[model samples]
Target: MSIDSTRFILLNTSHYGNIGATARAMKTMGFSDLVLVAPRFADALVHEDTVAMASGAADILVRARVVGSLAEALDGISYACATAMTPRDFGPATHAPRPLFAELARSEHRVAFVFGSERFGMANDDVYRCHACISIPTHPDYGSLNLAQAVQLLAYDWRQALGGFEVAPRVPDASLADGAQVQGLLGHWQQALTDIGFLDPAAPKKLMPRLNQLLNRAELSAEEVHILRGIARAIQRRG
Candidate 1:
């Protein structure tokens, strides 16, 4: 699927902030096309809530269009996917985003992801016409999702199928504590626990083994080992 050819269609959005937030979400995933199908407000495209939510992605909103109907919104799209729960009976097949997007990525289809309004989702009639329904798996107890959040998730998964950007570390990873450093910390901790009578050498009873397991699970850094050793020293002094 062409990222440029993909557009997000919000159907009858009631909340204006969601419109702006959706623009921001689309921009982050390298999607630019945003079409609103009959938003509640006439000036939704330029609404302050939309602009404020767009943040650095104001360009997306500037290029966004407002349409009267889904048919008009999907004018040039080859495949349209509705974002909603699967129809229990007989409608389009419902798929999770990743697998569906991966399948779509193999083709040159111009896809549009249609989202329903925040209050009431898309009509069954509207969903029946789509090629497939895309459902983001959520807890069975509560599946309610914020509109922009759903857009962000679908956009991210679709972008991943199209080869996402590599993550760059903001800071270098911390140096890990070597076995020798860990052994030293363990020895120091042993002394502290023994002095405090928390562990009796005569009747250790798996206490040291349990502490070892705890530290091993912690996956300590070298700096953390040194800090822990200092605490052990303090404990011994207090004892």
Candidate 2:
């Protein structure tokens, strides 16, 4: 089956440099129509360093759309897979790179591949959102991988899957979390932290910063943020 832009997605990447590199790689594979789902580097733009890495596909960087949530990022995607270095309890047993690639080769539906951040991999809920798991095989002694490395690897396989077939037309997906939804979640998170003694009003110095870092790092999707807010409200009620 031929590949289309709709069959792929990159999620929660934290660096502009990496995003640029990813755009280049996808373009190299003859895939564009990239959707950034609440990437940490939401302010990213086409810069010299990124363009340098993108090489021939620098234009893809300019055309990329940055959205606020994974669900929005993944809207209309028929199949979903999370790329993780480690398997989690909530997800299916992981697949090695080639096997996952082979399976993807067989499928005809739109697929999305999610890559988590540099530090913690995809969260439990995010993994649950995927239909399968793809893991890059690395040295057993040092299994960690950089974000761009992971994206390039998957994109490489997808390119192979295309295998001389012309790529299809682009179809846009919906955004899962709009601005208002994410803001509401942030507000609830802030309130919950304040109410739970996590943020002391008398010395509201370090906590807000740390909370901001955590919330920002999470790259919370609209649905995820709302769900988290609900959990926060539940916790507050119990307290």
Error of 2 at 236 (Å): 98
- How much lDDT does each candidate structure score? 0.90, 0.72
Span of 10 residues, lowest total lDDT, candidate 2: 1-10
> Tens-digit lDDT track for model 1 on 1-239?
45679989999999889999999999988999999999989999888888999988889988989989888998999899998764647788999899999999989899999999888899887787689999999999998889999999999999999989799899999999988999899999988999998888998898778888889899999999999999998998899
Query: Best candidate per lDDT, number?
Result: 1
Question: Candidate 1: what lDDT?
Answer: 0.90
Give each model a TM-score.
0.71, 0.62
Report the C-alpha displacement of residue 207, candidate 1, in angstroms: 24
Q: Which residue pairs of candidate 1 clash?
A: none
Q: Give the 10-residue window scoring lowest on summed lDDT in candidate 1.
A: 83-92
lDDT of 2: 0.72
Pairs in steric clash, model 2: 72-175, 72-176
- The residue-by-residue lDDT of candidate 2 on 1-239, one tens digit each, is 44464445666666678777888777776777677776665466465666777777777877777777778877888778888766576666688767776676777767778887665677888788888888787888997777777777777877776564466759654346655776677677778777877767787777666766677676666667767888989978976
Clashes of each: 0, 2
